[model samples]
Target: MGNSYEDECRRSLAEEQAKSLAGTNNWEHVDRERVHQDWDVLYREITPFLDGGSLPGDQQIQEFVRRHFDIVCRFYTPSREAYVGMSLFYAEDEAMRAFHDSYHPGLVEFLGAAIKVFAEQGSGFAPSAGEASA
Candidate 1:
């Protein structure tokens, strides 16, 4: 099958959403090397919002993971069949938790809303409350 414009649009939207959440147009600066070397910095920079508890951080994580992981699943068919993978790594790592906690409320809410818009306009993959249960 061929890739669709909808797919391209979804990816573009996701990248934009992630960039806005990170408060930088420089997300390209984030990669495995950066994630490994500066995770603490990234987490510290993004946590307060995740911890605010006004909006659900887990749900935001779920949607982000789902949209990104779906692209992975299209290539690696056996990785899993879920919209969002287990989020097991996020659960097992303290730094990941800290990263989630660091998100500013405004940013987190914006991300959540953007994810909702992406789902509605593109994928229709609304994150169930249970998906964020972890």
Candidate 2:
């Protein structure tokens, strides 16, 4: 059989992601396995807040959003506007929504909400540890 829908989405997203990194030296230091591990941790950590019916702006959920932001910063530093836009993309992009929801139903929406909250709060631009801001 051919790849599942989720697999196909992942493959497609990876290609798009690679293109987004073109000409950026930041990708040179990225550890794919470590980034994946961090994302797993983020998803696991955030699920409880979603399951408990916490709102996106809840203190706990916002804290997790900070972690999520740092994880994303591993690749590139996104402006507040860009970060908010990315959150929206997660919900609006069919493939992104499908990939995220494959982990947990409603996860994409929850994460998008929390990310918007984080961006709205004007969180400082702190890249992940050891990363220099561009």
Candidate 3:
């Protein structure tokens, strides 16, 4: 059989990611391996909560979201809007969703909601409820 559609999508998304990051000086100094390592750890750390059916606003999940924000900060500081926008992208972008979900099913949606909750509460710029849903 020819390459499956999911494989093709993965290839296309890889290309798109490379193209988007190409020639961006801001990303030049990023420790990509470290970022990948951190992401792997984050993925493993969060999967259990998802598997256990915890809501995104759960305290433990929000803690992971804080770690996620810190990981992003390794490259650049993100305003609250930027953080929420990134979360939306994770949920809405096919490529990003595919990439994240590769580690665990439904990870994209879970992470997105958790990130939104974090952005609203613990991002250090906004003040909101600690238990609100995304």
Estimated TM-score for each candidate: 0.27, 0.72, 0.72
| RMSD each, Å | 13.9, 9.5, 10.4
Question: What are the per-residue Cα lDDT tens digits for candidate 2 across 83-119?
Answer: 6657666887899888778778989988877776787
Residue-level lDDT tens digits of model 1 in 1-134: 12353344344445434444466444443454644445344435444545565343355554553544444333232112122222322333577444544544244333433334444444434333224633
- Give candidate 1's error at residue 3 in angstroms: 32
User: Per-residue lDDT tens digits of candidate 3, residues 1-134?
Assistant: 13363344345444434543664664887898999999999998899888898999999898888888888777655555556667666777899889899988889888877876786687453211222545
Better of 1 and 3 by lDDT: 3
Q: Each candidate: what lDDT?
A: 0.40, 0.71, 0.71
Q: What is the lDDT of residue 89 in candidate 3?
A: 68
Candidate 3: Cα lDDT at 119: 68
Model 3 alpha-carbon drift over 4 Å, by segment: 1-24, 125-134
